[model samples]
Target: MIQTGEKELKGIIPGSWHILVKFWPQIRQRKLLIGSSLFALLLETALGLLEPWPLKFIFDGVLLSRTDIYPDILGFARGLSPMWLLSLLAVSIVAIAALRSITAYLSTYGMALAAIQVLSEVRSNLYSHIQRLSLSFHQRFKSGDLIARVTYDIERLRLVTIKTALPFLANVVTIVGMVVVMFWLNWELALISIGIFPLFAITTTNIVGKIRKETNKHRTSEGAIADTTSETIGAIRVVQALSLHDMLEENFLIQNTKSLQEGVRSLKLATFLEGLVKVLMALVLALVVWRSSLLVLQKTLTPGDVLIFVNYLKTAFDPMRQISKQIGQIAKAIASGERAIDILDYEPHVRDLPGATKAHPFYGSVSFEKVSFSYDPSRQILHEVNFDVEPGQQIALVGPSGSGKSTLASLLLRLYDPTVGGILIDGRDIRSYKLDSLRQQISVVMQDSVLFAVSIRENITYGRLGATDAEVEHAARLANAHDFIMDLPQGYDTIVGERGGTLSGGQRQRIAIARAAIRHSPIVILDEPTTGLDGASEHAVNEALNRLTRGSTTFLISHNLRAVEGCDRILYIEKGEILERGTHPELMAQAGRYAHLYRLQNDTNEIEGVKHVLEA
Candidate 1:
């Protein structure tokens, strides 16, 4: 189950220690909870420390003859006569039993409550940070990977935080308290009992460190599987349409296999480490017994003292084993900490300039001053382009695919900034305005306008949240969506399926248009708005489009030259530069690239007409 690469990693003691030290702030907060938890552990450690004294007293004072033992055996049994020894023994046994019950209840609950509180805070913060990352980051990371990190990897921390880790720490303090008391009573016996610790540390570091790294790999593999599943399911339509279901399943199985292998390997290594701890405990016990017996015979130590040391030796390994068991959890926690920090530390590519303020309500005059852009630093997607939109004017951008039409629209919306130049709204550089304020001045509809899975009313009013019912209806009517929305079973209340899949393509486009219409921004950017519609549907939508475009600074991007012909001016773009710029009739009259394309379309239509005439 464990990968070979992970198994070969040498244990680095200092590095792991530094990782813990660096995260001391997180530890301190947990320690405050651990302190509350420590209160209960104090009673448990005290009960354990007190436990040995009573037994030592019983052995020396009553069973074996010793003068000094009387001071430790607080309650008297011998003074009450022959019935007294049995009564005292029974009371001593009951006292030890009662102490254990109080120890269990107080220590476990206090630690459990504290761990959960920290987990709650961590999950909330991590979730909030994910939301703050830009849209581009989300596009690059798989949905399933992000989901698994937040839910699965984070849950591993939660499991260890409450159940395994804090308890182990509390017990370490308990074990230290036990050792201090044991050495105070008899240093020679304590030293003999503790000799196996260095060996235990060696064994634990080798096995647990290897296993901890593998556990992280298993978590990563699980994320890959989840990512594949999420992607497949999200695009279920494409998968079914292309008959890729079996291929996707095979891919998922490959990732799942790796996860399963790591999980099994981690389990095996954990079991091996636990068994080694038990073996070390036995060895230490045997050593303590052999050493203590010789002291007893030489009269350096009494039989009573030898007996208490034997019990001490048996339980002394508990803390070492406790720490060894928690190493995997601590390692996983460090891994989670690294991921959460990566997100919090990353700087956003776009940040508003210092002292930036809101752009006042737009006057619909958008100007590009030698604007240029590139998604990557090495290649330019747009050349230095200059243009200006007169207030309330309609301008059209005509181009083939990859001519930077969509990128131009994106810049206007402030989805991205130009690499080499600034965009000015009215007379001000857009960068000087607050980001949200800059975006608010423009409303847009792309070729594939997205609608959420919600009611028709909700879809239309998405552009302006908190819009009144009357406003929602008005926007729908303005986009020519009111008649169809009324025709649906529930009128405005009709629930649109996911991405408005329940509606026809043209219907979905209209709903998206209505959403854009509701914004009522001064600048409207329509990017290939009616690309795939039927002739009659395009005519119907164009009627609503005409109503929406009026009185706004409308910038239209379309592959269809006819769609832009009606605009006041058209910019025929080729590559990164504008090939021509004029009103549609002027471009047609100029006999350039625009005129050539127009003639081809006219000839094709006439040819189809001639064939029909010949057939009749």
Candidate 2:
């Protein structure tokens, strides 16, 4: 979802007005449409106020024949017969309603269009911002929740903008116009009609805060449900193999039930407010009718004046009832808008500095100068690590799991900067170069290289976008992936499933190698690239890797000592420090940690090989 600052999260939730102010820039972009909509709204409110007056004139002048009290604006109607006057007033009512309907349509359509355009742009920008956030930030948050904020939360805001905001604005203007007219008709009756407003305001104000709180709770619960569903679906194969259905379902059901409870609680508060508004409105109506009847009997007011007063009261109070009914939805939209604002306001922890410039073509000399790093302060992952690799050299880093071998590769690529020292390329600190330019000069193939659900050609071209079809095929061939790709029905055009699930482990690794090959970067990193593959697949992937990294500065992080035996130099690291560094023969001759591990690994391999022979 939106990445809120710690301090911002602890503060009070902002009101709807504050949310609107935050989004005012986007709204201001559509000023022309908003202006036209406002004009239409004013016109529509004017017509609605005029609606009851036609009937007023008919009651007082046409039926009762009260010409003395007739409005000066309608003096011409005095000369007409009662039948003609009644006919004219009826036609005026229909005319006023038709005009009001047209204006209403114009205003509604304009606002809805503006809302859609503005929100769609906001959604796109949020998605882009999320992608650029630091990898640490992504690891800390659930992807499903982020998806919920980008899609569902923004959608909630759009719906409220169209369905609730427009009507609320129109009703506000109508209320103001009706109130002014009511006072003009009779000051005493107007006072009685509006006297209940404070009670209505107090009732709504007291309950609205609770409704908003419950809405926030409901939204949080929904996000949790989304995270659960996303995590389960992403690892469906593992869940099915492990028989985790019942356990996962139980967790999902808890979130679902909590969401329902909070949702219903918010709705119940809104409903109570609506019922309270109706009661307050009824009280005002009763007092106005009773007082107006006495005035009519005493000849202080005309029958038509009483009729107009009651009509205005009902019209004015109707908007209050509608607002009360919609409080829950409005609160939900405000919560969602706050979430979106939080993300947009967040600055990426790692971004290009003001003076950063494009990096020049690198000769692939990499140096880590006393570099120390950690994902968190509680535990350091890498400590005082010093190393250097010349251009065109192949270095192997053999370490136990979690010994920071892959983290060193990550630091070289600038995914995360070293906490205590600098990484330099071609003798220049990497931070001096723009992030995108620096990263473009290096390539990586992780143990589980991810591929999108697209054609094989498209996946490879992602390494260096705009690579031609011929270049893609050449890269595939270099990686030893061309034969199997061609055997497929669609050749290079064959679509891969998500994460390349449709392909065998060997085939996926070969495609990933091709992607790295197409980049043609001077620096390459292979992190356990053949970890889980069978012997045949491992051999094929190793062959392809050799072709791809032929002239590049390559750092190979692997557990299999056999692969490292061929590298020009090998570094045996443990506990975030390089324990030994030498050529394979030299390390073996020294009989240090590297020699001990190498002999143990080879012994295990020999035993496994003999067992395989006997079984055959």
Candidate 3:
């Protein structure tokens, strides 16, 4: 079994860079999208830097009575008048805004499309991997929690990619551009402007770091809330029958309260961090302004220079504060990725070996050679058992509950492999066959015959996908389900509710028999097929089953002794061992455990029949 708990959970929650690196395969597939978005981002950043330049020209050239252009280092506006330069600068601002708007849209839309594509692939892969995992792995985890990981956690990655991941990258690029330009304007003033960066970094690290930690806790709590809700709703019938409304409500509320508390704590830290960044940026502006004013008076700097320095400082600090706010989301995406990746990383314990080949047609000659099994090693469920059955024989397995009857069927279907020894068909080990081909050759009608929420025709055809309409109706007729189905308003097209809840137990069982009959496999396993049914319903289902299992190697597992009379042979099993094997009359003649149990049930039924007669 794939083990998971605190240790595995902690192993998944990797750092931000780790998340990026781990998902690189998805990222690598969208190179065109990434390249387009990056180009647009470059355009937008370049335009943004030009945004403050127009104001610089207006300040130094128009307002200060200068004839040369503000940035005369290029000497491009040597012949232009002050008014002309001001008008040209105004035009430049409008053009910059228009270009920036177009590029911003492109970058934003492209990244969003890319992120959605990558996350969709991730979700698909997670679901596929989860479906292939062994039953033991699934039994170890709650279905609700796994659902949350597939839906909720994977969704977080989508939001983080578009909302947090892309934006964070853009901000880093903008910050770098601003730093290089600030130094070019005046190395001395630029140094003074960025002196508070160390302080800003320290404050953001302290608060956002805490927020990230709290956000991780918040995400986990939300998953718990999802799990609780799923469990409660899935079993709502039982909850209502037992009046467990208040108890479930209390449990759900506790998880919701914890999630709310963690969310609030993260918000508080993020808000405080944003405020601290603003305060520090204000102080940095004051120091830059004071020093720049002295340089202007001393003829060492232009007034436009001060404006550019101050504007760049604001631009740089603004993204710092934005980063502080998104720190929580970044942490959440990383945590979600960890949970999602856990599913994808799991290796199924029951997958076929590399050289395994498809199974040939089975002749139904099965041999269990010292087969031993256990779900848990300390408590063995099936001990060194051996048995053989010929083709077209109906063998009944009669045993007390938990005597390894169902386990034997599961091993035959390869839902799990045996712990020791091997099961063989036609003297070849079953493990040598490919999993799908082996399972497809055996038809199973479980106690609770599961039907999909689809058309009656579709449900029956599931046994053999793409079966013709005539073939489907033929199978239904063989299972004695055709008459009632044809009587319904929509006939074969009638839609069944989930698990066939709209139909009676007998109706569902007959449809399941029809599904199995359509497969026309050589081997059949009927596990308490008539269980939990009234006498009339059991009689009807048994009639259907008789037609379905004719001429097939059948294993009938039942506690009802009356149901086993037609079986060709009977095996009496107890405490993980088969103690007696014979036909019904032969077992009764031997007066073994099977005979004793059968006589006791016969006496009980006689008493129940007499009581029913008196009540009637």
Alpha-carbon runs more than 4 Å astray in model 3: 1-25, 65-74, 205-275
Q: What TM-score would every model get versus the actual structure? A: 0.79, 0.87, 0.88
Error of 3 at 166 (Å): 0.4
Across 100-158, the per-residue lDDT of candidate 1 in tens digits comes to 66876767776777656666666676688677566557777788877777787667766
Runs in model 2 with CA error above 4 Å? 1-24, 68-70, 201-281, 614-616
Q: Clash totals for all models, in order?
A: 1, 1, 0
Consecutive 10-residue window with the lowest summed lDDT within model 1? 1-10
User: Each model's C-alpha lDDT?
Assistant: 0.76, 0.87, 0.87
Q: What is the lDDT of residue 116 in candidate 1?
A: 66
- Tens digit of per-residue lDDT, candidate 2, span 1-616: 1112222223324656676687788888999998898899899999998888887788888778988766688788889998998898899999999999999999889888888988988898899999898887888879988899999999999999899877877777888888788889788888888788767755665676577678889989999999899999999999999999999999999899999999999999988977887788789989999999999899888888988888888788778656653555666677888888887887776778789999999999989899999999999999999988999999999878888998898788777888999999999999889999999988888899899999999999999999999999999999899999999989999999999999999999999999999999999999999989998999999899999899999999999888888898998999899999999999999999889998999999899999999999
Report the lDDT of model 2 for residue 359.
98
**Who wins the TM-score comparison?**
3
Residue 311 in candidate 3, Cα distance off native in Å:
1.5
* RMSD (Å) per prediction: 5.5, 4.9, 4.8
